[model samples]
Target: MTIRFRPSEPTDAAALLRVWRRAVDGTHHFLSAQDRVAIDPLVADYVGSTALRIAEKDGEVVAFMGVTGQNVDSLFIDPAAHGSGIGRSLVDEVARPTTVEVNEQNEGAVAFYKRLGFEVTSRSETDEDGRPYPLLHMRRD
Candidate 1:
């Protein structure tokens, strides 16, 4: 299991979207099946604060991560590739004092970030979406 990290390119957008939507669906457990669909592949580029990165194994993307300024826009791995250390690689490679807004409902990610030595300084809502997401702010130690 040799995982490789690369700066993401425009060509890898589709693969990144696949991983992102899966993570979104996992977050939106309450949404109806029909509403679970992602809006569009173009939405990611428009998300305003995303700087994309791709993780490949055997020359295929297995994970996607985006860093916007100091915030982690998202970190996603194929379900089959979970626990493969891809996420940790992303964090360590881009290592900086960072902040991320996790769906308050996604306890697993919250705990994982904490284990990595991130302390939540506050919680807040998502921008105008009224989704009540928590803004977890952390300074990497």
Candidate 2:
């Protein structure tokens, strides 16, 4: 699989949205169907920012991410493409120290972040749906 990361352009919106929905489904936990209806617009808005990233595999977009708060906001990979290092590439490309929040229930993600050198700075609550989410701030370690 040929994987590459690039800044998002306005013309990339539709493909990016498809990647968002797929990346959400891969986890099969965070983004419920209702969550898409409610949160997609927020994703759309996040994409409008200058920090969005699109991950392409074999000439097709397989993942995407948004960086904010000096951290990665949304990082999603196609369910079929997990473990491909695309996610880590998104984080590796992070220009500064950053943080990522992993739902306490998502052990895999928590481990992934830890393996990638993110430390547990604190746990946080997510306002997106008013849930108590755990957060980890990751810097080069």
- Who wins the TM-score comparison? 2
Model 1, TM vs. native: 0.79
Return the TM-score for each candidate structure: 0.79, 0.80
Please, what is the whole-model Cα lDDT of each candidate in the order they appear? 0.68, 0.72
Clash-forming residue pairs, model 1? none
Q: List where candidate 2 sits over 4 angstroms from the true fold.
A: 28-33, 48-50, 125-129, 132-141
Instruction: Report the lDDT of model 2 for residue 65.
Output: 78
Q: For residue 9, what is the lDDT in candidate 2?
A: 86
Q: Please give, for residues 1-141, the per-residue lDDT of candidate 1 as tens digits.
A: 678888777777777777767666665564445444434434566332355778898887888877867777778777667677888888876557777666555777778788777787767665225544445555565
Estimate, for each residue in 45-116, the C-alpha lDDT of model 2 and write its tens digit.
666655578888888888887777667777777778888888888888776677766666567777888898
After superposition, candidate 1 runs with Cα above 4 Å error: 30-51, 126-128
- After superposition on all C-alphas, the RMSD of every candidate to the true structure, in Å, is 3.0, 2.6
